[model samples]
Target chain A: MANGIIEKVKEQATSVWEKVHGSQVAESILRPGSPFKKGYSDTPRNRSYVIMNNVLYHLHPVKVKRHGVRLSYTLCLGGISFFLFILLTITGIFLMFYYAPTAEAAYSDVAALSTSVAFGSLVRNMHRWGAHFMVLSVFLHMSRVFYHGAYKPPREFNWVVGVILLLLTLLLSFTGYLLPWDQLALWAVTVGTNMAGFVPVFGGQVKFLLLGSVEVTADTILRWYVLHVLFFPFIIVIFMAVHFWRVRKDGGISGPL
Target chain B: MSDIPEHLLRRSAEAKAKALGIPVEDVLAEMTGEAAPTPMDIGEQPKVETVVAPDPATPAAVPVAEPETPSQEPTPPAPVMAASSADAGDVDYDAAATKAGMPASLLKRSVEAKAKASGASPASVLAEMLGEEVPAAPPAASAPPPAEPAPVEEITESVAEVVEIPIVEPAAAASVAAEPPAASRSGGATAVAARPLAQPEAVPEGVRTQRLLTVVKANAIQQVKSEPTDKVNTWPHLMIMEFAALLAVTAVLIVLSVILQAPLLESANFNATPNPSKAPWYFLGLQELLSYFDPQIAGVTVPTIIGLVGFMAIPYVDRNPSTKPSDRKFAIFMYTFFMMGAATLTIFGVLFRGPGFNFTYPWADGIFFDDLKDWVNF
Candidate 1:
């Protein structure tokens, strides 16, 4: 009786799977060369189509030099940096749900994540570490490109764009460092901004503009929050788009050397 | 025919007359049939003499001369006649057939049928069929006997028809030969005699005689700037490795997150400042520089001028084209030196500096950095 019941359940599950996968909706969603698309066979033509027909084609060409694919050649540092940015964004959004950008709530809200919220501390930890990793990866990626002399000739402008991206990543990481509104966040930002106040003539104005006042306050938290979550992200994304495009246009990742 | 502008027709007639080495009036008169065909000697015309193959076995080789004069209208019978003279032994028939996308047997059969009908060798016919220039004929005197007069008349007729027709479809021309119009039965009969004995079945629409517009040598048109490099598809090759990297990074991040809790200290108390307040780890290197120099030089000038602008200028300033490590020793050395210096400064700021920002060993001072407070206990 149990065996018959199990067989019936198995048959029903198979039918449901077939119904969903074979539906027109599913077919429409899975593009022509998508691996998940029904009846997708591995062929040379299909391999080309897989990139050509997908959005990833925007970032990567249909083919790259064989050496470009090797792990040691690039160390995949650039790709890892991009992936870390995405991971941070995901974890950042989750943290935002429980966070408030006010001095009164920010510290307690962060502390509560470790005690009350489910996976909140874990996600927060990921966001923090991921941001650090992104900074490290972007720096390493720049170093790798320099070591390959990939910045020469047509790639010179792309290297400039890369430097700008690195600056933006640092700014994003620095701004987020203050969101917790703790003693560490407060003093760390104070020391950092004190240096900004040392800028020659317009130092005072720059410091005021950055802190949203003479010093870090509730207003500074809100300002940094918006910059961290929205403004910098928007600017960085545009730069990343141009960077990825120029990589392909400048004839892809530099050399075997 | 009346719809064609007179000057355009006259210009075309002039071009044809020049090609055929005859008067424009003669060509115009021949087109209107207002006079008898010009009795031009075939031997005097270089084009005609060049096409007159000495090998009697390749009688159909005559039409191979038509494609030489760019101004002349394409003769519908040329491909047929050319296919018939496929006896040119130099061409690899199997390779040509494969390139042309047809079975070798089918190509051979077509060549044989055309050859039998026109009394031409199959080798020369195949060569012409493959769009290769037929080897220059010996002379007009040694030209094949059977099709000698036929080529001259065919040339004049094709030249006369040039101004009236913009394009001639081969299938339509074949049909015209099969059922000649009442007015042109003699010309149609000559075409029919030269036609291939067995027409290829179901010839795809794209398979038509290609006309050469110009002959720009490969070097003149294509500038090969770079050598073809070894390449692999991004899908399974690059993408698979990329996926592995992504997964590996994610696993590491998750494991790190599980083990290490990100620090959150007491709420901000502006009145009671923490001693030795330091910036984020990334900025610690700059702060370390602050201890050695004026704040303006270390903080503002160094970060802006030397750090950001200087790094951006590396490629432009270096001017060294070679990427080889051995060749770029100076560039590599400077970068490595800068990296090591910054790393040392950052480490000193993070671990050595204690209360009142004074230098102190982390082991002796019980570690002042709050971010790492949880990881290291006194």
Candidate 2:
């Protein structure tokens, strides 16, 4: 059995090597001590060195000389945003254990959370404020970058992507804003969606897409509840990663003019 | 490229040609073949050239006269020639002069004097060489008649001696071989160039505020003069300031959160409806707008559209230099105006709009009918 497993592994490695490098090249490259090596140098001063040299270094550079400390903690607006996401993930998971999506139980589960769960208010407030903080910080962060002229030259395109992400973030906030569905929430959403009706071109289509109907009824609530809980967050996270990648690619908020 | 001489280009081209396996002879032949015709081709076809075999008989007659004439006459002859050309110059040597154009004539006299010494006119003369049209003149003014202005012009000739002797660079000296008249013309005006204009180079009054801290020393000025650090560098200071602000806000929020515990409003009552519904304050702006307009336009559409549009428009509108307050004036204005307007409108709506058409609600009907409809119906 061991021999068979070893043979299988060898066959897979050969196949992988062939795919990455055609047979002749792979055969020559795989030959040991061919002089040239791939990837970062292992000795030091590069990524591998950074990883091997310091024990606490696995987190990547906390503060790059360029992207800054706020960006480092991801606690600046994006960080606060990412933190809220983490808090939401945690609180959301716990909330999920007790809560049912069904209209019958969803409100009851939330009530139970307030009355029964220890630190549930803390979790709930943290999540709530986290969402708020995420929105506020993200906007603040975008404004900071804008004022800094960080959006010029190589970063111009990224700024456009950032603006898109900002819209996504507002969507996340709006969809989440309706989840509790009290009179305040219902009416607030009613007020919110009513505003969506003014979109010069996309107004009706967007309203329909959002509420699933002409009014904020049960269908509207369920749709938003799903989007708030699931869809928008997933989409935002992918975009958030892309936004950070672009920031790094853009050479870290081009300082001043 | 840092002033490397032509040989380096030649050597590099040769090296490149060799490396490329191109024949050097073919390259050299091509380069030279294209070059040889250029001098004869581009140099003007001189109307007066090929004088080399200048009439053999004329040369013999000229030298025969050269031995007889006084050498002093040769020196004076060059001066006479220069005066004729330079008199026709910008100075107007004024075959006459008014007090105003005196700089021009004295200028010509001085140029004439220098030509008597130098033997050739300068190759080039600038506009100002005609002497400054300034009001100073002891020369032609003293000459009784324009014809006898020759004496004043002569004095200028002598005066040209007192200046302009030491410029000895040979290649530059060649430029003046034909430049003696220009020198005489230039001589009168060197003083006029002394235009004591106000100096922008003078230190600014702002320097009074420029004193360096004792700890920073002279280096502070030098440092700032070159590449001063922006506020971002004072990271510790910013941290302290941010924390101080955060602490103050935290204290206030905690006090408020404790003293006026945020009501955990009755959980999700779908049936027993709250009489007056309200959103979180951050959103009251949108909720408030609902009162002023239709639900579709005011509530659902406008806020979403505004939020998206405002977010998108930020980069376009805020084209300031940097994050500094001095930069981005419009950005600051628009942001402040929008936020304030939104906040104010929202607050006014929540505080005064009074339950948003409350009389239309089921419970408000009895109060509505008794007070409002009773008058209308009666």
Candidate 3:
């Protein structure tokens, strides 16, 4: 049986080599000692080619106006806001490892995370501050765009997309505010959602939908924890993709008008 | 600016007025003054060429001079020749500008200056260069007197300097040479160009075109003293800038988070509602508003309207084409007022509102920090 297995493996290796060597060009490039460099030539044309070939880099225009990236003009507020979102996502995931969404365990889990888990406090701190900073930066970005009149003309639709994003940011922050299952989180969310309850026809229903009950219960904690860590983040990602894509389509960050 | 047309100025004024339910002339008067400045100019290309180029005889055909001149003294003869050539061929300003390695807005302005220097109506010159019929006579009043023409000696000196330098790359000259007649044909018919006396009859159109192309090329070389719109590539410049900003933001956030722990009070107890339950800082504005009006109005109706009208409807309603803040005085005033009110209300909610959500100064008991400590120390 061992001899037969060895022969079969040798046959497979031979076939693979035959396939590889059948194409002379592939054989030359894929050979163990081949001198081929993976990157394109360093010419300006090839530099553009590199951008076009890459998936991530292609989102950026090969050339951008200097004003679009000016520190004073944009303050890179949008970029910083996005970076904070990424930081929150990472830290939030780390927090989840030590967290329990259930009301019976949620607050205790947080206590345990802070007391037992290494770097737990640091991660949590980063996430909290990142959330607040994201909100602040997004607000400032909107103001920047408005003051610069960057929302005019072709960028009008992008501005609306941006507004939706602003709403998303607030929603994300609000939902996450309740995850700690502490008095501040609980009362703050209750008061904040109560505002939503003031909606004309669907106020009570909306509140019920959000809290998963009439008040902040185990279900409410679980639902908010899920929304904060997963659902809202997922939705925000979708909206963010559309937002970034639309910004590019609307001629990259609006400059002047 | 050669880039912002007078018609646009008028249209923006009209739109603002109509939106505000005021007279168009009033809007015009309000927007026309200090709002027009080159300081922090956005450099949008003139839309006038598209609108006015199509009909040569239209009253809008009056070719205005360049609005902002380069701070650096430009070579007089170069732009004069460039403008004349641009007019002669109905040069596709956008394409030619690209070929000359300058932005279209700046090129348009430069061309206008050139036209003004040559004592020609830019549109008519373009029409003539394209071999189109010129308007019978542009009323003398239409032509503004030349603001300042470089002295003949200075102009010649500059012309000599330009010719000797050969500053423009050969590739750019070749590209410029190729674009003219094709672009000129589409430039719209208006008038024939009065041939420059310096033109040699023996020279072919292509050769003359080459010389004119050189003029534009030279202007671009000279204009390099001015800031360029797209100076650096986005990859390194934008990406690096964004990364640096992220690092800075992270550093600030780290310090803040480390210095002040986020508040996490005792596990939620519905039976023990805090005396003045408050929302997050962002919602403080709405919460403050709730004190003034019914919850339905402050929380629901007003926010919804502001969202729909202030953000969504702004582009459609405001419609003032000028992006400058000075020009957008009324819009700015409204925005400022709304922002200030929201900020004031938020401050009141976050700081001043005390026990039982009653209005109280932050320092009602003592110093502001002592009161703040009472809340935090709890």
Candidate 4:
């Protein structure tokens, strides 16, 4: 009697799943080539459709050169850098929810994250470390491209775009460093921006613009906060789009060499 | 014609436009009968007929319409054998036949059969079979007296002369065939009968002579210079590896996050400044340079000129196209030198500099960098 009930339940469960998967709503949500779509099969053409039909996978081509897929060739440094940026963005958004950007509340809010908020400390840690990792990975990716002579010929423009992206990565990291509103964050930024005051003619003006004052203060924190979270990310995303596009346009990854 | 959907007609027009190198709107206009058919439109009928009916006699009849090129009008009677010898010099008939996926003997026999039926020289018949221009027909006056077989050697020898025939203008051929003189001048009764097939009037209105779909030449729309590469699909092959890399990075980041809490020191105090205040690690190298040179040079010039402008210029400056390490030794060496120099400066700034920005080994002075202060306790 128990076995028969279990079998009946099993059949009911299967039918329910089939109904849900094959429903009009599900079909509309899952595009023709989506792996999550009902009746998807593992075929070579379907494999191509998997990339071609999906929005996120649209970043990559339907196929890539065999050698380009090997971990050793690229060391996956560029992909890691991009992935780290995404990780940082996620963690940064979580950090933003509990913390305020003003100098008066910034430190206390950050302190409260560890003491009061759930998983706040962990997310903050991830954000901090992920930013640092992104900078390192971007620099390493640039080095790898250089060593392989991937910046040659048709790839020259892409290399320039990549260099701009690296600079943006550093800018993004630097801006976020000042947001913690601690002694370390304050002094570190002071030392860094003080260097900007040494520029030839517009040194003082540049430093003034960056800080929103003659020196780092409450206004400077808010200014850097907006830059770190919104402005720089928006700019970086645009450049990254061009960078990935140019990679495919300039003939995918460079070569076996 | 009216029953076809607008989109289907538009699509067919697009294919015809692309093949004929005309504007799609023009083709569409012609297809809709909104614009009168040009001479070019009438010209396609015979080519369509050739494709539809591969009968041997049809091709022989087809070329008789070529009064458009007066140079092809002179047909010398019984010059079939003589013209064969002159025209068949350059092309290797056997090699061409093999490449076309037929035996040399089979191609010759077919040519012989076509020549006999059409009363054209065997060389011209061979040219037609190979999709090449048939050599100028021997004079209509010399049309080979019924079924006289030409020698094989003469036929194969005369392919060279066919190269001199100007590309046939189908429009001109269609118009020329409409005249009685040209139709009568065709070599045989079969040729005269085939002339009407090329006439635009004979085709039923709205009958699709060509299919709407065609394989558009890849080069026509985009530059496809690349050779077939050894490739794998991006789904399981590349995406799987990408996912693995992503998971590995996530795992490492999560572990690091759990083990080491991010640094959040005492709130900012304007009065008390740390002894050896430093920039974030990435800017450390520039700060390190601040100690050695004037702030203008290290802080302003170096970062902007060498860091930004100079790095961006590397590709444009290094004209060495070869990606091989052996071939570009100097480029590789220069980049390696810069990398090593930057690493040395950054390392010096991060670990070696202590209180008062003075040189002090981390082992002796205890580490001064506050970012890593929690993780690296001396």
Candidate 5:
């Protein structure tokens, strides 16, 4: 049978891997209980140990309900959204090196980065597209949860947490939108902050807090740059820790009930 | 157009008072004589009678029919049968009712009334309804026994039962095909048995509705599963999916970034505003709203308040315990409508607005990409 051949090939391949990776360094790094090392036997117990022992793998549980993993149900949207966020963070950090967030320098810096710096456009593009993707994937993730009724009961608090995360993602994108400081960035932010000025009692105060002036300026660019680079990302990291922790505590992604 | 039977009203009042943590005497004292004739005020009384009565005509017996009841009478009795079968016998009906979703007060009155009317002991009636045993009905009902004494152990057992229900249901999580047969509760045992297990003929080609019973059973047998019985490990399952997503996203973005460069149209000049200056795509939804309302409501008040209220109200408003989408049609529909409205508004703002902010389709001139028209022309 094809399965028998596959099993034989897998056995051979694993033994070969073990032989190649069986040095003293490998052994030190991958002890019997190490997440990097698989146990002698390919049993469920060992597989579980593989997940539980590793610092990175420990985030997930040893056993998973089959329903929770169904691709049709989840569409892996939340995972994709999280992945996109990570990608954005990495690319955004690189973009920050070349970007100068000031009224005079912002536009020229972006133009130079794209035209002169090697792979600078590529990095910028990845960050830009990743932001857009995270927004979309987060929205789709919310929709998936809604459609699946995964937001019901015990998981209700997590759903609210997810909504807050979604808002944070939007804010992240909106703040970053102005860092380019071109005609598009300037006008788009002008229209956006104008909306904040419509808030009732403390509208003007909030607008001042955001723009640091009656209009978008050097100060506004600097404020948005700090938020996009540091302040918002820090808040997001804290919220994400809670969000994933709650997902685990609230019984792991709410299978069919 | 008659008053609720004085005895039935008294029992319902006592049950409600108990549920509300109020004294029964205070509840009874509060009701005036003429209030009884207004069946509208005593709506809870008829619901209790309906649950208790095995017959569909039970509401008529409660004397609160008000000539508008017969049409809607059949609906409640079916659930009574389901309530008994789903959590019958040694399982406390009151506790099971709460779990199987016959609320405490409603099931308490129903179980008591049904037992009294049948002249059989409550436990025996419950057992009989479960199709386990058929206790003979007593000939006479001249004297009824007082309610059973509740021991400490029994109270604790019921509490445990209530706590355990939620955990058990998700573990016994049936497949889509298995659900319909179980959920069609009114369709008796024979009917359920007659239905094919995984009706291949019913399912469309290329789609298999196979039950994951083997996986569930394997998980059930193991004390220490490699992963949580109810969850998949994130490393391989989730990590792989996310990695694939990242690759696909990066590839697409690469192609896009290579083909079309990001726009950088000169420096910001305060004197020169783009004719149809607009917000980003995400805030385009709000910009669209501004067209219909005053800036305060559309931009600040409505958006802020609606987001807060909508997110917070989900748990409180939707008390439906089931998570199956089929069971939650209205919730799905309303959410879909809200999302679709936002999408429509964003699309309108992003693609339709032109110079002077007037309506213009994507094909029209004076749009964002109008300057690139010569290069883009096919």
Candidate 6:
């Protein structure tokens, strides 16, 4: 009886919807077709459906055959790296709230974040270590994917994205270096950015822009700060989206050997 | 019709329509056509007209309209199952069929075939054989089907339509989930199902235990992903990417530390300052221009503007993978070399050696700013 009432209500609601929005909505709601196909659950929509439906689902293979080393393969290293990147982003933002880019007090801000604020030291260390770990994991992820032949065929562009991400990781580190504004920070940035001076035609201009004029000073520190904290991160995120989208488009990672 | 059960007989006309995969009216129209030819042969197209019911005083008459539905050729049903049944079951079939190599159809066929071959009714054979244990076997499922041939088509179609759990060919996309350093292949569908599946891998005695251990072992392993092997192209391969990276990072720290020993002093306290009070080496390029423009403009304003633009533009300039270092080696190399030279020149001018004022080597300093007037502009 309840089902009958609900069915009647559904019929009425459908007609009402059709009246308001036309029959397309009604047709779509009642289409007789399967939403998915075989061998292609790696599509972005399906992946998210799986992830949101079952969080641990991504951790396991679609088919689990009993092999000698099945467990080792099921928990991917890339997933770990992706998780750590998330950790770093969170901690980095927290640290940012306390850090100032000016040479006058950037060092003290770090020192205070380490010793003064509540759990500040832990947050800073975690951010610092998270950065380190993410770099390591991402590197390991690339190697694992390569050895497994995952970078073949459809996954090629994602490899390129990974490489770009690697560069961005290094850049993030380099930009953060100057936030401390100590002699060590200044010289380190100087040496790092100096590598840019090798460009053929626009080398000098690139150098001037990075240094803010001719050298590492307050301007350079501020530049590195914004780039590290804001610019590079924003860019890296966009690239990451494309990378993941490509992974889905390319039919997921290469399967077993 | 009299022998059929009431529920079976009452199978709704709606159910019949659904099962036949045709509209109720269409079936009626077809039956009518066969029973008595229509004056117009019902024309080609069946026009789908919506029925608008008026008040109870008058009933709307049902009428069949003709409309041309595109002709769809009958396609054979694919032999396959839904990837994972979100439908129903508590099937012990897999366990029963494991040793038998049997498909389900064959299980249904066994008694029938045995009865026919032995000249006994299938029910009579089952009644007499009830007490004897017929080990649930799979091979028997396939044995009886070949001679009949009809079931082969059914199995073939099911095989095509079966929705596999692993959407990607299992062998094709397994590594996506392989926790780095270990490739645990728990065949069948998942680790959860592998417990039962592992029983067969034990044909080699301890093989089952080992497979279980491998699947269990992946839990504890430290899965470090983002391996840099393929990225060896970005960095020189000779250093062994990781080692080179480690070395490069260490070199960077060392080089920076060495350069910091003689950091340029801030111009804010320059009166009693040492001979060269330049900005940091990283700031040298800007300091070189301070010699020309006012401190407010060259020292603060210009650098500020450039820094804002540089950072803000990064996402726009290198938004995609096509601009990666591996794809644009020369561009990366140039980016590196040019930035480095400029940094060095700027540092050298501000702290150690300048075009004017102080007299020190940029590396060791006595350097101070010299005017274009005080020294050669070039």
List the per-model TM-score of the A chain. Answer: 0.94, 0.70, 0.81, 0.97, 0.88, 0.72
DockQ of the two-chain complex in candidate 6: 0.02
lDDT of 5 by residue, B1-378 (tens): 125556656877788677666667766665533322212111111121101123221212322333332212211212233334433445476654654465767766766776686554565444334321112222111111111223323222222111111112211221111222221233322111111233234455564332211111222234543222334555466656656767887788778667655666778887789878888888888998998899988998767887766776687789998887788889888888988899999888877887767788777564453223332542
Please identify model 3 stretches exceeding 4 Å from their true place. Answer: A1-43, A46-50, B1-231, B366-378
Question: Which lDDT values do the candidates have, in the order given?
Answer: 0.77, 0.48, 0.64, 0.75, 0.64, 0.46
Comparing 4 with 6 on TM-score, the higher-scoring candidate is: 4
* Per-residue lDDT of B61 in model 6: 26
Model 6 C-alpha lDDT versus the unseen true structure: 0.46
Docking class of 3: acceptable
lDDT score of residue A11 within candidate 4: 100
Model 1 chain A lowest lDDT segment of ten: A30-39
Could you report the DockQ of all the candidates, in the order they appear? Answer: 0.60, 0.10, 0.38, 0.60, 0.36, 0.02
| Residues A62-148, model 1: lDDT tens digits | 999988998998999999999999999999989999998998899999999999999988899899989989999999999999888
| lDDT over C-alpha atoms for residue B31 of model 4 | 72
* Candidate 5 docking DockQ: 0.36
lDDT (10s digit) by residue, model 4, range B1-378: 686756667778888898888899887887787876543322343221111212222333334433343222222222223334425544356865865678888887777775776566676555445432223443333221122223323322221211111223434443233222322234321121112234334457665343111112333356745565577898888889999999999999999998998898899988889989999999999999999999999999999999999999999999888899999999889889988898899999999999999999899988899988889852
Residue-wise lDDT of candidate 6 within B1-378, one digit each (tens)? 244344433444346557666566554444334332122111122121111111111112212122222211111111112112212233233443443456656644774675566554444433223212233321112111111112222222222122223213222222221211112122221121111222232345433221111112222344534221111111112113324444444454335333322222222221233333343333556656556676556655555454334423333454334423366565455445745665675655655554333436644533354211122222
Lowest lDDT 10-residue stretch of candidate 6 chain B: B71-80
- The candidate 5 chain A region of ten consecutive residues with least summed lDDT is A31-40
* Per-residue C-alpha lDDT of model 3 across residues A1-257, encoded as one tens digit per residue: 99999999999998897676656677555433222323334565654544454564636777777667778888888888888999998888899888888877888888776789997877887888788788888988988888888888888877887888888898899888888887777777888888889999889999899999987777888888778877888888888898889888877766554
Cα deviation at B358, candidate 1, in Å, is 0.8
User: Lowest summed-lDDT stretch of 10 residues in model 4 chain A?
Assistant: A50-59
Count of backbone clashes for each model? Answer: 17, 21, 8, 12, 10, 102
Predicted model 1 interface RMSD: 0.6
